[model samples]
Target: MIGRLNHVAIVVPDLEEGARVYRSTLGAKVSEAVDLPDHGVTTVFVELPNTKIELLHPHGEGSPIAKFLESNPSGGMHHVCYEVDDIIAARDKLESDGMRVLGDGEPKIGAHGKPVLFLHPKDFMGTLVELEQV
Candidate 1:
């Protein structure tokens, strides 16, 4: 069902500052902030093999990102996204295993047009998991 660790998302107060730190301090090659209006965020992606570090800042106070930042003071590890060959199959597997998905039906489009679904953190021992079809 799951393929690889895709990315660890981080909610940041400043996207630019986060990108600078990841690039200059950690020596990561950072991408220009990618505005995902549909998701209500401006994200900077630090590409890594089979995984990445996504720096996210809220587009506005009403955005979900803002609430996430408010909930987790450290703003680290908002979600652990997994890469899968088949997101639909992954969702089915999770459901059959008695996991509660955060949706009613079909999965939705995610970053970069990838199909994605969220398996409730309550079901995975408090780890918010995102399954993405790449």
Candidate 2:
């Protein structure tokens, strides 16, 4: 069961600039930086009243953000993350329904160390879907 919209990830060329915009300009309280080495991403958080936004950039070649930036250096919206109660079950259903999983298989830890899995955009009308176990 998906709980709610957890966060929207936006790839950026500069993490500091992104933070300044989302924090000072938007009045969002920024959180600590989160490094997901496995995914090759360095993420920073912006806490909001209702939800949060994650500013992302590639930390290495393995990052999806790297590929995203290569195609469009200006960066763009990466994906939307939804909170889920049971990621395993959700992944199973999506898999059985023929959703393409981005990673090899199984859920992996995300920015906040929560179990996360991504559904290929081809399965969601070009919108990448991410499920995070809350």
Candidate 3:
């Protein structure tokens, strides 16, 4: 079902500052912020040797990240994405095992433009897990 670790998403109050920290301080390669209206987030990716770190900021009032920021204020780890060879098959197996999938229980186009599904945090030791099809 789960394959490899893809990327770790971090919610940031300021996308530019976050990317700057990763770029200047950590000396990482950061991408320009991209607004994803559908996902309701403006994101910047910090490319790495193995995986990536996604810095996300709320893009709109209705964004889920907006609600997250309200409580967190400083923002924090949003979710960890893992790759799956076959997302549909993995979803079915997880569902049969009683794991709850978020967002209509269907895969959506994620930040990577790949089919992705989020599983309930409670089901995965209090961590929101994203399954992305490879």
> lDDT per residue, candidate 1, 64-109, as tens digits?
6787888876677789998899877787788888888897848889
Rank candidates, lDDT, best first: 3, 2, 1
Q: Quote each prediction's TM-score.
A: 0.92, 0.90, 0.96
| Model 3 local distance difference test score | 0.92
- Show where candidate 1 strays beyond 4 Å: none
State the C-alpha lDDT per candidate: 0.84, 0.87, 0.92
Flag regions of model 2 displaced more than 4 Å.
none
- Candidate 3, residues 1-118, lDDT tens digits: the string is 6777899999999888899999999999999999999988999999999999999999976997898888988989989999999999999999999999997988998877899999
Error of 2 at 118 (Å): 0.6
Tens-digit lDDT track of model 2 for 75-114: 7998999999998899888889888888786888876779
- Cα lDDT for residue 60, model 3? 73
| Best of the two (2, 3) by lDDT | 3
For lDDT, the strongest prediction is 3
Clashing residue pairs for model 2: none
Clashing residue pairs, backbone N/CA/C < 3 A, model 3: none
For candidate 2, the clash count comes to: 0
